[model samples]
Target chain A: MTNGKSDLKRLSRGDTENSGGAIWHENFRQAINILRSHKMRSGLLIVGVAIGVTTVLAIVTVMSGLDKRVQQDILSVNKPYLIVSRFDPFAGTKDKRDLMRRKKLTSSDAEAIEDRCPTVDRVDLQVNAEGMMSVLRYGNERTNLIQVMGASHNFGYMFSFSIEKGRFFTKFEQDHKARVIVLGYGPAKDLFPHRGPIGKMIKIGTHRYKVVGTMGSRENIMGSISDNYAIIPYTIYEKDRSSKRDDYQIAITIRDGFTLEKGIEETTALLRKRRGVKPGEENNFYITTSETFKEMLGNITKYIGLVLVVISSIGLMVGGIGVMNIMLISVTERTREVGIRMAVGAKKKDILQQFLIEAVVLTGIGGIMGIILGMFAARGVAMLIHFPYSVPIIWIIIAFVFSSSIGLIFGLYPANKAAGMDPIVALRAE
Target chain B: MLITVKGLKKIYDVGSQRIEAVAGVDLEIGKNEYVSIMGPSGSGKSTLMNILGCLDTPTEGKYYLNGSEVSNLDDDRLAYIRNREIGFVFQTFNLLPRANSLQNVELPLVYAGVSAGKRKRIAMEVLDLVGLVDRAMHRPSELSGGQRQRVAIARALVNNPSIILADEPTGNLDSKTGEELMAVFNKIHESGNTIIMVTHEENVARHSMRILRLRDGKIESDKIIN
Candidate 1:
């Protein structure tokens, strides 16, 4: 029996006048209740989502931080755009050897370019010797495999080194070929602890060089050049017993408004003039731009990041499939509930939204927990490696959004099937 | 007329063959009426109740509820009518096992978009009416068959629908408990809410003012006893 008067009133006040928010909240609350009813199933579903988000977040954060460190290390060495060297490879092989024998870069070559080439702003000449070595000892413990570099006085300005304990070598020391050396922060602390390293005498192989200053901890770029080396004067390295005329590498900075191409052209012309290289002869030495160096490092990191993402994606995919399977089970288990809601004026859209939101909330909460755990894991890793712990905020946001969207996308078919159930059949189901 | 059906039919296609559940039926019921359609197994009384409750639309002919053509209505419209006009109780006392009596009573109002505060208040009032107010927080499994049936009745009354459709509402209870359920139904009818019940027991059908007996998919007799 139906009463028209009350039926119309109920229709107007009940379903028609309710806002979408009210419907959504009611459906969401019911879904939460259903989840509470099946605690084990809900927990399993959440763990799936947590695994997915954690893998993604961890991989992304580690890769992004490593990428930043690599870039910073490259920038500190040289301006990425300029390449200044003596070698010209475009002129052919026979001429390259001839040019190499005659036109090897030296300290004078760097000076001539700085004077003649308007594009050359600063010049740094580095001389490295295989015979150059350092001995680090702390109370009978010593390391013999320490590399030592001979650098100009402007080494700190050119390479962005922060003096942690003492001062850098002065211009007078470079000109006079002083035997004083500066120790990087790591080597200094390792060799001498609980005492200041400045004004200390450290033996480098057979020679005794005075420690003048100490460098700060430099960012490690994929373990390439860490703050564990020793810096000495370029002139002093040249005059040492193991030094030779051929063991030199020169780096130069370009002036403002000068392109790398111009710097390369001017430096090549100047070297050719100084070394008497014929027009048809090729240059001997290799010169690389900072941009090219960075490109090489970036390619390595890109390949590494790609591999990590692919590996992490495999984990996430398995987790996503698990989530989908669980949602399917949830739909089948709640068939009668779906039918009852459908019979009681819930639109198919309403049912769909309710289940989908439930899935998303489940995964979203899991994702948030995973992110928190992953951040701690990353921090633990960074601490183990003695690197700074950085939170990857961008990856965190992406993980959250991606996990919820995965829930929505994967939960759709099951939710629709549940919403389409026939009430009579469902209610009559034993 | 609160409900009118003319030549109502229901056909089910199970695999290759067609089975007629309700062949042809003509019936009218007025507001506040307490009526029971009684039949043996496979006699089609349940099919008639399904049509009357808007859980199933008639396969052919017209069925009107409160002067609205409901037989040809789509699924969404049928759902609206079911939620707004018909409240249902089943033989098994089909309350959601996970839900307490209060939440079970609030289910229909939730779909109707009633505010939570008002929904709870109305659900409590209906539970009080069914004498299950003290057992409101107890789930269906915690209650006896008689108490569970009372909880289902309270759920059916919470929406204040135009009619209550009970399909053997006391079918699972003892005779004493069944009598008590019928007494509750009698009190509900006296309160001016229409009720349509389907029962196989003649004694249960006798509680209603009117009875329609069905056999072989058609009404065998219709009688008004009160």
Candidate 2:
């Protein structure tokens, strides 16, 4: 196209010296006319590109939103905390079976970490089961959606849980196996709307426990049912619901001036010693910091997002090829017109630019429509999943440029074929 | 001299056959001359016209247009000379079907890099010159055969080219409409622009000041028409 411009400048002088505005304007206008004349073909082409762009934009937005939500809910509050568990949080079925074969972590392991690791400040042991929905009843208010967690006395401090109206259970209460509980904010609000939840008796599975505390709302956490849960001391849980072989997950917080890495390292060593893990074998447990957990979450989401992008790009490629195919047909159909253009003074570059611009415009329109549709789709999914809505400016730019580049790359062959036509033969075409 | 041709030959290789379309023709045409080349089908007049119009280059000779050798010029440079020096009217009245008459007329000037304002003014004036001012916005598909040819002629004249070349310009029109188009060409010629036309009909050749008759790829006669 640049060669054509310079040639025009050199030749368009003397007695015929008047034709000089950026010639692209005329070519662009002509291209638009051609596309408009073939409405159905152009419409299908636009829709193809739009679907490709929409897929990319929607997936990037939703996945990035989920990533941010995970950071806020898990990593943000637990940056200085580490978890020691019987199974990996990110385990596949094979890894799960391997970890299941190993002995479960117990309260002894938790106490051993605290006693031996210099960086450890305190440890909390929590025993919980899934797929077991327990209901809590207080007078006329009942919540069948309750989650039951049995933990040691320091669970609240380690996990950033604060008491709103009362005190947390003490070591004396835990040791005595007292029938006491702390209600999360959701259950507290639902059961005791106008009055304090402390000192109230709640029923759970033919047992009654006095509410020792009501928890403050957990700010910025997402997708956790903790708000509807109640906590009971591990001593009382061991006496009532848990058996001797029941496993416990431990949360450990580092002391001031210590990093979670140092805390995890020292604690892992201590557990290896306590559990008599052999020198040549893997540890019989999993230990992970919030940072590691966040990375695992990010990697999974990124992998899924990358696969989706690859799939969507194929759609874009098909759309781009479709544009090229239609443009080739157009060139063949208008062979006589091209000959006339050549006879009248259009340079080879002019013809090339004309067709290239047509393809780009076709896909550019699709990209714009796709962006709009993508935003709406992402927003819809975000709303459905309770994920926050965010504008992904970088992804939008990438989608636009990628779609336009697709047009350029694919449009080259047909445009070149048109430009290289023999004018004499073209004029003779019917 | 507006055009000078020396030892012009055009050979076509169709499969194994080497066919000489125009063999060893020599011709000279001075400025403001109204000349016609007459020949029967396959007698090489069309090949000669293609060479003179800059649509095709000669295989074995030199063509000089306005003192510059053009037979060996490349495609782009040939396109430039075609834009600036020669105006072409086809037998089919080859105006772009999608463009209106005014746009068709503006084409040559557009290739010459004429600005929009001047291109429009000149295109309008050329349309007026061809007596089709009222049909400026009518596309070729919308115009009668006479009007379409007039539009093609107007296009040929738009850049005020050195010579107007019409190839059987009246071939597609009825005799009456053809007469009307010849009158339009007579007006264009009287305006002092050199004109070269290719035709086989004697009546069409009679409209020119001089005639060259081609027989079997060679000039049979060059005559002054009184």
Candidate 3:
């Protein structure tokens, strides 16, 4: 009776020692144990995945952010369906560079299209003229070699420019060729350090023009184009300049519900007729739309993104291969252990899942670390360059999923080999 | 009968040449039977034990356990049989070295799809039966050889399988520890579970009720030792 009571006590205690949760938890525990056993190997494997995911994430965030900014800037400059001067008529021909240098559109041609093309919503003409070699003097400070631009009265509305101070020049001032000018934010601060520029006179070359308005701060597109220029009426530019050739560029916004393609077709026919070009002769002007601009920008960005993704994938591939090789080594090192498991009724699939899960967990942890590092790195770079920092959630999710899948795919061969091992032979393996 | 084998044979192929590991053998083991098979290296004792444990299928023969044909079963069905009816122990004290004694014992029940609470209770019961309840959380590496073997014994008993197959279970232990492990096996057998073991030592074979000695892939002697 004493022995029976002791046996029951023993049985109760033994039961407590032998059981846990579900099968997945058991497998997960075993998997974590195996990975922890080889600390250096597992650490190195995770580092590889981290580097791969970091590279991919950083490049993706920067590229997508740049893309969004460029699209926004383009839309601000012109509507999606608007057409602009393409600079060169025969740019696609063999002597494209030479043809580009020869083709120029004058303001008269822009006016002709506006009058003849029914699909055109509005026409804006922009022309640049040389400012006299003069210094912008306000009180005691001065700046040299500043660029100045001349535009029609509709320039502010057409290009979405917002006035930060005062107001734009009226149609009366523009028609009378008034010597009133609007200063960009940079020049405004440089010229007037203490007081407002409204009603003040600034000398441009030989003429004095009143500062009627000032533009807010604007960012340059793609890091090369400059937005630090002063604006005046086109009549003032023509009256002051000596050149007979008008290098005026035209921007034509298409009417609502009108396709850019149709607008381009009709505008092209009208321009050709107005330019007096015969049917056999090639058209002297070129037409470009915002969509074409976006396509060209996208192509360049796509190439950059492809290169970055490829470089990152190479890192991941190396990391995945490293994981596979190390896991194979683990199987060989633990051959007897696997044999014991098989003998004790662990199925082949069980062994397979165990190893595969370990690999995935290693890579998954690495991916998480890499994403955190990459996001901070990208934000640091954006801050240094004064660009808005954009956190790309989609790229973060993608990096994690991609790295884990790499682990599963690459770990398959090693796991299958382990599962296929013969228990007797494995037990005997040294 | 808990286990039945008829004309069991196993052949291995190496580079287009076939070598017979186990020739022909017939055996029957009833409930609560304690048996030992003794043989030198390569004498087919291990092969026969593997077939009995459902770890290997005979090249040509039929094996029935609890009245079901296991020799012709597919891998999934065979795995099911192994999980539900057979427990195994090995000379190396084949517990997962990183796992604690309790976790090692609970493995088979996990495969059996038992719930956590029930599996834990059963595993703890077996550990107590083997007198290792105090060391349940100790990993195999942390335990002595005898303790490791006892853990293996606890693991073998956890599933309440019909048969416990042990191969040289005390090969890595000293004689005194080996005797202690044998005592635990005796207790397990007294509980009405069949135990089949392969051993090379005469004293180890004498501990069982029946002994079979093999040479050159054939059983040279069979006797009722007790």
Top DockQ model: 3
Ranking by lDDT: 2, 3, 1
Residue-pair clash count for candidate 1: 1
> What TM-score would you give candidate 1 relative to the actual structure?
0.81
Candidates by TM-score, descending order: 3, 1, 2
Off by over 4 Å in 3: A1-21, A37-40, A72-75, A78-81, A84-91, A94-123, A128-148, A161-167, A183-217, A221-225, A242-245, A252-288, B12-19, B72-76
Query: Distance from true position, residue A39, model 1, in Å?
Result: 3.0
Instruction: List model 2 lDDT by residue over B1-226, tens digit each.
Output: 8889999999999999999999889999998799999989899998898899898998998899999899998888878778877788999988888788988888777777677776787678668767899999888899999989989988887766788899999998899998888888877777677899998778888889999999888898999885
Write one digit per residue (lDDT tens) for candidate 1, span B118-202. 7787778778778888999999999999999999888777767888999999889999999999998888887788999999898
Against the hidden reference, what TM-scores do the models get? 0.81, 0.79, 0.84
The global C-alpha lDDT for each of the candidates, from Candidate 1 onward, is: 0.78, 0.83, 0.78
Best by TM-score: 3
**For all the candidates, what are their Cα RMSDs to the real structure?**
5.2, 6.0, 4.9
Candidate 3 residues A72-160, lDDT tens each?
65456646555445355324677766555545666677788788888888887777643432345555666555667778777877787
Question: What local lDDT does model 1 show for residue A50?
Answer: 86
Tens-digit lDDT track for model 1 on A1-430? 2243343244334433455666787778877887797799888878878877777777676776676677776567645345444454344676654555544467787678778989877777776655555566544545546677777776676777778877888889989988888988678877777788888877765677788899887756545247768888888877764444345667777788988788889888877777776789865556667777777778887789889878886776676677678878888877777766765667778888988998888888778987987787777766666555676677789888888877888788778877888877777665
After TM-score superposition, the amount by which residue A281's alpha carbon in candidate 1 deviates from its true location, in angstroms, is 15
Index of the highest-lDDT prediction: 2
